[model samples]
Target: MLWVDKYRPRQLDELHCHPGVTDLLRKLMDTRDFPHMMLYGPPGAGKKTRISAFLRGVYGQGAEKMKVSTRSFKIPPSNSTTVECQVLDSPYHIEVSPADVGTGSRDTAIVQILVKETASALQPAMGDKHVSFKVVVINEVDRLSHQAQAALRRTMEKYVGACRIIMTANNFAKVLPPIRSRCLCIRVPSPTNQEIREVMHQIAVNENITVPDDLVDRIIAASGRDLRRALLMLETAKIKHYPFKANQKPPLVAWEEFLEKEICDTIMKNQTPKGVIAVRSKYYDLMGCMIPADVILKTLVKMLLKKVSGDTLKSKIVTFAASFEHTMRLGAKEIFHLEAFTANVMSAIKQANTSQQQGGRAPSPSGGS
Candidate 1:
């Protein structure tokens, strides 16, 4: 197993970071009956870990026994087509992401089907008598369409008796206000740099490996406060070389390196329609490989910010990037938005150059107004 999963916390108290959030979860578990929960945070911030620990506290060891199955459900109205959805099932809970069932109205149908199927049934009599309701975990709740989210809201209200819905989202702003109001929203912020360093040290001790302090600092800097990524970086570094060098840089995954070299470099050097077209092809290549459009746009913006010198140019690039990113989320064709963002950045750079060039031109010899 990878170090990220191997070092994962099995119980709430076992969790090293986010002590306040752990305390709140412990209190909720103590009540034995808590409201629906919405856990929102950046990636690798222990949202899923907390959920697992909370369930285990309520359902005991049975909650950890998990199995994966692909279940098919018929779409509503016509009831003619069936979509297959992968679900992770435990004796105590069922987890599914509606976005995984494919896009459009089908996601709404899957959300309705899964929630109704799981929530309408009463909890089976297991060894634990105090546990009366099962859990329905919906991952990537923010990606659900408006219709799907609306369906989820209705099901959540109707099935409050037999089950509880726990949702995880990277961005809570995308979730509808009505749904947000129904659940007890919990924000799990990313771990601090100190917290990440401590975890790295603990993992090193457990593995009996000597990780130099400088290498640990490098990993933490590259991880962006994501503990999971930090752990993965450490393991990858260890695998490459056992006795680590203090100056050894942590390796970036292939896609990140590719973006930096191929995409970002191309954008900086070429700022024209031809440049936009060339970048568009590369964008297609990346998307064809299953890299998400948002990840691509985000990395491109970050890299470009570092390359560009002036604050004004960087701010303009960020503004345009944010606008296009929001558009990408709402629109179907990601390539269009990605290309548009590239063009906008190129345009900004060109304008800045024009202003600089015109300002640099000396006054005419006649000095006439």
Candidate 2:
């Protein structure tokens, strides 16, 4: 499949992020001082990508061995491994096997097997004098049970040789306090539109996909700061023409058609920007192809350029965009956040006009750019 997985970013530099995180990961790699880490972030972000790269860099072939220390290699894959993490009780060597969750009915059976087997099997590894950390990497940490977590905690403490446990989850509070307390938490934030745009352009060239210049914003907008999702969306956009890949390939989705069905009607008539923003909020997550809040802002910027005089909307848009970027960075709520953003654009233009009209300085409040 081109989507959901195939377009995953494989390199550290390719990660959609600010420079600060890249710097931290580099330092951790240099010193091998990574503590048991918990990575929390929104969906489709680069949490998994960075985690994989960090581990690969640190533990790759011919990688440096830790000094005067012991380590337990724990890599959680969907398949079983021969790794020593579950060597004793798990003859197959994967703590949680797919069979456990493969069927709807057997989930608890799988969890129990993992908790019992992993807890006991790890005790001997803790005995190694040079071992300093029994590192366990659990994916979907939230899915683990209260019982599973209880058993897991003992291993962390009893295995004093272990440095820590690193788990990834979309929600942080679901983790037990004992587990959370033992490690430092890190948040992997979403990618920005600019970051997503670079990845999209690269994807278009690599895959020979076509997207309109304006719809380039649509692609970036749809991905919601997720690099993997963005690239995968590009790939999927091509595949949606599948069966037709040999003939009658479809044009990339247009900017307007890609907007919400409701927003489309309002915006085409050049309705109030406040009214457009108000309506888009209703179906924000429709069918995985609808535009995002940030993208809505961009689309409106395009509209302002077309609708207003001297394109006075340009300077106002540039300013509003900066504020919206920060608002998203702070994890603002979408409906209220977007409403405020659209409302401000309308108000700011009014202020600029007021300053212009009253003795060359007067104002009027209007929607959008």
Candidate 3:
């Protein structure tokens, strides 16, 4: 059991930050006709935790008793193939990740099937309570294909009366406009440095561990403002090196940052055929380590943008990054698109330099004799 899961807040009051959002949610529970919610924010910012806690608040302890099960659904028309999906269901509600359903056109069918199933079912009677609708939490809604999103929009509208949806996404813009307009968009911003530190200290107290103040500071800096990551790092450090030494750094490997900086430095130092070949090998090594190609590309872009100086050059590189990122999303082979991006960046840099040199070496006023 990870510390993140162990210490996860079970109620709204336990949230470390976003009190305003919590207040809004509290009011929403009081309303008889609360609209569907869409919580979007950066990763590890407590969107999932908050939503889970909110559900527990609205329903009861039974909401927390979640169990995962996989079920297969027959596709329409010929029904030759089936799409299997795992759902986290509890007495109060169920959670689904549509992206997990078998890939391709079947993904769209998964959304439609889930919506239909939820709409068709009616809640069982409870003592002194006769609720009619059940909650359905959809995580990573943005990852669903456009076709699936369209189906979701329709199902959401059709079943709006029987089922309540709470969609969580990291990128709100990627979500379709129809869905966004239908749900109440809630933004969960990342926690601040102070908020993260306080939560970590509280966790240490609860665990009966004595983490030094300086060490806590180090953890905060390394956590990148993500409370879940901070807690995990604290626990990792405790397991690796206990006794809580003063000024001890968090035992985080930071492999992602290291890889990003190494690749970025290599590109900045040399933009040539030989350099491209060398960087390509490094990328392969990274891939061998199981780092996803999209993650690699995103990290490299962040580092490369920092290294690039001129505004024009930076803009050009950004355009290249955006184009390659979209291509990576559309194409199956990520390595090809990522490597192509690196080559394109190298070419852009070389072109910028050539243009600068030509402009600087303007033709002499007098022709050569």
Candidate 4:
């Protein structure tokens, strides 16, 4: 199982930063009794884990009450320590039932068939008398089959007085309009750098992973507000090399230099337009090395915000930069996308040609307004 899932935050209070969101959730869950709430956020930004914590904390003893199927869904263990299970002799001669899998439409007819079965299995415990408070859950409800979602909508409404939905997704538009209208909506904004750093540090301490001061920035850079991704990077880095611990001198390069290297590394790949490869490579780099594309962008954003020499060209540069991100997400032919993006950046630089008359110099490394 991935370290991110393993190290997922279990309590609302433990979710570092975003206390505003946490505080609101706390009050709502405690007093308001949320109904079909939607939590939208970037992937890996603790959306699933947060809702899971809320539900488990509120209805753990009755967790099995919410199980749609007896079959397991390959959930990752929630902590760093390993768990092992061995085969045992069964006098009962038990038979194991395979889990229902895949999507509807194109996937298995069995998957479509099981939709009703799964819902039926869950419907009983979800019925009144068994449920005291609304069952809280966040899932990719957008991926539900049309029939399944319709059934789920009934479930939501039927249980609204008794249950609350905390569905989450990367794209909110994919969610069925009926489902979206039934509940409150909240955005789980991605964590900032300091928040990510604090998470990694806590996990490092809990797991006994050694971290160097210099290395912490690298982990934070790679996480991009995805705490799960950050924890995985920190664990893997510890497997490769330990970061400095508390009371020790931090890394020698300093935070500023780390930021510069991160940006250069993000864009300077010796690549031939495989933007998908580059983008995935960047994410993998963060997963394994703790360096992320957004972190690099933020450094450049600081430069642009500083209104340095290139700052004069920031407007156009930022525009094309956003284009680059959009193209990357849309699965354009990478070579073409990166080519256009890089050329646009270079064009912006060229547009500032008049500025060079002062010293023939590009912007200074020190970002400033």
Candidate 5:
């Protein structure tokens, strides 16, 4: 088992970082009318961990005993078509993601089917106990299609009294307004550098390894403040370079950084239609390898910001990137928007250069003319 999973905080009190958020969850557990929750944060920021701990806090240890099963459900009036969904089930709750509903054409049907099933389940009578409602945990709620989100909103309202929905997303902005308005939104910010260092130290102690200060700093730097990533990097380093050295760096792939540099340099050198054609192969290779468009755009923008010196030009470039990123989200063809972003930035750079060049050459008009 990966060290990340083995050392995951099992209970609410076991959580080391984000004490304030955990306290809020504990208080909510004490109440009888805890609202449906929407936990949003960066990936590996402990949103899921806190949710699991919160469930265990209210529903006891049984909530942690999870099992994965592939279940099939037929769309109403269509016995010919069925949706196969993988669900993580436990005694108190069942976790499902709309993305796990296979490649069925009618993806919306799976969401409706799951919601109806949860609503129809008999509410157990745990008189004076906290486990009255069955919890339905949905992972990656932001990735759900608009149609599925709409169906989920109606089901949420209809069964609000019987079942509780706990949704997790990397970004809450992607969630529908109706769904966002209904749930109590909770932001689980990423862990700080110091917190990540402490966690890494604790893991080192548990593994009976002596990680040097320089090595620890290297892991923290590579982690991007993600605790889980830091832990994984630490383990990877230990296995590859055991008997920890004083200056050993974590073994992590630099392909993202290299790709970012390649994209930015390609745009900077050739700010023309030819450049767009030149970079098409790079984008194709990435997309063909199943790299997400958002990741590509983000890395490109970040690299451009670092490589470009002028603040005004950087701001303009970022604005253009944002516009294209949003278009990528709404549209199906990711490469079009990505290529458009490169072309747009190149145009901006070329226009800026033209204005600068013209300023130096054009004669100034006489003030007293």
Candidate 6:
């Protein structure tokens, strides 16, 4: 088993980070019935972990006994075509995401149909008494179209008596305001470097492995504040070499290295039309590797931020990256936006260099240009 799964917290108290969030969750459970929740945070920040722990707290051991099943639902009105959605089912809750159904109008139908069916079903009795409602966990709720989100909002209101909806999303802004108003929104921030270091040491002790302090620092830095990635990097390091060297670099995922060396370096060295075309080909190569367009754009921006010097240039790069990313999300073709962002970066770099060169040749304020 992978270390990430093996060491996952089974209960709320077992969670390593987010102690304040843990305390709040425990207080909610004390109520016996709590409001619907939306847990939003960056990837690998333990949103899913907290959701699972919360479920376990509510349903006992039965919540952990999960099964995966694919079910098809017929579209309304015509009732001709069908959409298949995969769900993780436990005794007390069902988890599904609209993205699993695909992009477009179908998501609206899937959201309405799946939640209606699950919520309408009768809840099974636990040991002594009947559980009043089931929980529907909608993963990545932010990815749903506005129409789909509207349908979800209605479903939440209609089925308030039958089930609770717990959603997980990376960006809170993408979720509709109506949906936000109905649920108790919780933001799970990424772990700090100190918190990450402490967790790594604990895991190392449990595994009976010795990790050097410097090696741990390198892993933490490379991890981008993602704890899951940090743990995976540590495990990979162990497999690659034991009793590690002091100067050994932690392994970065291939895509990150490619973005830094092949793409970012190329942009910095040659900011020309020809350079943009060359980088476009590399973007396709990354897409071929199944890396998401947003991820590629995000990583490229992060790398370029480090290489580019002035504050003004950095701010401009970030603005354009955000605009392009938002466009990518709304539109169908990712390649166009990806190329656009690359070209924009190249132009910015060229302009910055030209300004610097002119500044170097220009006379001081006391003299002439």
Candidate 4 lowest-lDDT run of ten: 87-96
Model 6 per-residue lDDT tens digits across residues 1-369: 989899989999898898999999999876767888999999989999999988888878888899999988777778898888888998778898877677566888887877788787865664122567888899999999888898889889999887888999999999999999999999999999999999899999999998999999999998989999999999988888887877888987878888888889999998777887898899999999999999999988888898899987898789888988888888788888887877777777777877764323321111111
Candidate 4, lDDT over the whole model:
0.52
Pairs with backbone N, CA or C atoms under 3 Å apart (clashes), candidate 5: none
Residues 1-369, candidate 2, lDDT per residue (tens digit)? 564444555556666566677678778766754666777778776766676666545544221232222213333344343222221111212222222233232333343334444445544322212232334455666656665566556655654343345567777778788878776678777878887777677666666766655655666655556676566655655667632233332233455444534543444343466664655554364324556766666655555555555445566666666776566657745555555555555555555554564223322322232
Candidate 2 vs 4: which has more lDDT:
2
Question: Which scores higher on lDDT, 1 or 4?
Answer: 1
- List the candidates' TM-scores in order: 0.87, 0.49, 0.82, 0.54, 0.80, 0.88
Worst 10 residues of 2 by lDDT: 86-95
Candidate of highest TM-score: 6
User: Model 1: per-residue lDDT, tens digit, 1-369?
Assistant: 998999899999889998999999999988888999999999999999999999999888889999999998888889999999999999889999888777767899988887788876665664364688889999999999888998889999998888899999999999999999999999999999999999999999999998898888889988988999999999999998878876898978888888888888888888767887887888898998999999999988888988997887898889888988887888888888887788777777777766864333331111111
Candidate 1: C-alpha lDDT: 0.86
For candidate 4, lDDT tens digit of each residue in 1-369? 666766666777777768888887788656534556788888777776677566544444333233232432221233242222111111111111111133432222222222333333344333222444434343565565665556556666654554445567667777678877877877887888888877767766877765665667766664566666666666655554345454432222334344345433343332223532454444344435544344445454554444335545666667766766565557534434444554445444554653455334432211111
**Model 6 / residue 97 / CA error / Å:** 1.0
Ranking of all candidate structures by their TM-score, best first: 6, 1, 3, 5, 4, 2
Error of 1 at 331 (Å): 6.5
- What C-alpha lDDT do the candidate models reach, one value each? 0.86, 0.53, 0.80, 0.52, 0.80, 0.85
Please list the residue runs of candidate 5 whose C-alpha ends up more than 4 Å from where it truly belongs after superposition.
77-80, 99-107, 123-130, 212-222, 240-251, 257-278, 326-333, 343-369
Q: Provide the global lDDT of candidate 5 against the true structure.
A: 0.80
